[model samples]
Target: MSAPDARPVRGKRPKSGDPVVDRALALLAAFTEEHRALGLVELSRRAGIPRSTASRLAARLQAWGALERDEHGRYVIGLRLFEVASLAPRSHGLREAALPYLEDLHEITRQHVLLAVLDQGAALLVERLSTLGAVQVAYRVGGRLPLHDTGVGLVLLAFADAAVRAQALSELDSPAAATLRRRLADVRRTGVAVFARRRPAAVSSVAVAVRDGAGRVVAAVSVVVPVDAARPQAYEQVVRATALAVSRALGARPARAE
Candidate 1:
């Protein structure tokens, strides 16, 4: 018979020597956009570990500076985690190269400007800027959006390596999968993607791919505006220009005239 303290682990065991690593990670995952801080009991419940185990893991994390105590005495993700996360090449590197252009787009348009990259089969928002009256969007920094439903997603899909594209296609329902293939071809031909989003009520986005030194598409830049205010296509040139500028900053040279 199992002892009263035993609790089943939530995820796959880590191959590393520290068997508690996965549990520690699960504790970290317990905090999210909605639940930014938690008490020991709540953290344990959410992480699917015993309270005793949660306390021990939290102690270790707090000691290592991966977690911190809030003024309210709840546990929160720590500065040390941010220090580590800031080094992620896909987000930090691209954001460093894209911020000036993204800020410019926001200042010029006074709208929602975003930068995204393909990550784990989704469009991961790396940065976003919005003006006082800018249209609201569903995405936030660190959030993921569907590659099939967003303008940045289309750009990424159009240029994604065959394996990533194939994996995405295989995950969708047959009809939508077939439709995406057609859209990808159009995006490739035009070098831009424009799409209307129904959420936040009738917003449209225009986006273009940003390439790296080897001319490999590494990220996308986009702007969101009201559908009735202006056609999304109207922003295509500026978005393309911004994306191109960022690509150049990353050491990408323009393609030779055909």
Candidate 2:
């Protein structure tokens, strides 16, 4: 397959000035969704390191199986990195518990189903399932979505600790913060969030919170569908059911009947 175009990496390089570890991490961070592979010069430039330093670091990383060279001799993220990432309890454990229900939801909707967790004040997508004819959406697995703007995000933010919510609110403008406060209150009251976005193709997402055995909200499950295809509320019940199923799989207890 043809390599995607290269783009500037997003985050700042570490300022610790550690020769080996920090530079190595910078090299890895240089690779992104659009720039998955890079030649020596591009890698060095993107990592803000000298070519010679990048070559040495890349060689070490390649030896450690954290990076690998492709057929075209460009450096790409290695399978070993994924293997290591798969051990992360937050993402991997949730994925294992939620995959079955997520699959069922995907089969039923034949649209986009997403599982995400709150990380670093944003919704970090852990898994996404979509079909060929599904409506276009900008989200990708491992991407971060705004807590104030997305359905899954709203569910997560609403159930987050008050301190966490306050920290997130501090980042937004007054009007947006007020709007999000109102929306978060609604999510807590209704146990679901229906969010619509107009850009990147008009779509609506219905999301519900997933809880663990301890009754702490841990993740959010969502379904994204074309706005014109159906009303967002139509999917709320099903999505909530799916989230409940996944939560049970994760050892969450059923609520006592009133």
Best by TM-score: 1
lDDT of 2 by residue, 157-249 (tens): 999999889998999899989999999999999899999999889999999999999989999999999999889899988998999999899
lDDT of 1 by residue, 157-180 (tens): 889989989998999999989998
What candidate 2 gets wrong by more than 4 Å, as runs, is 1-19, 256-258
Number of the top-ranking candidate, with lDDT as the measure: 2
Model 2: lDDT of residue 168: 87
The TM-score, computed over Cα atoms with residue i paired to residue i, of candidate 2 is 0.89
The number of residue pairs in model 2 that clash at the backbone is 0
Q: Candidate 1, which segments miss by more than 4 Å at Cα? A: 1-4, 7-16, 256-258
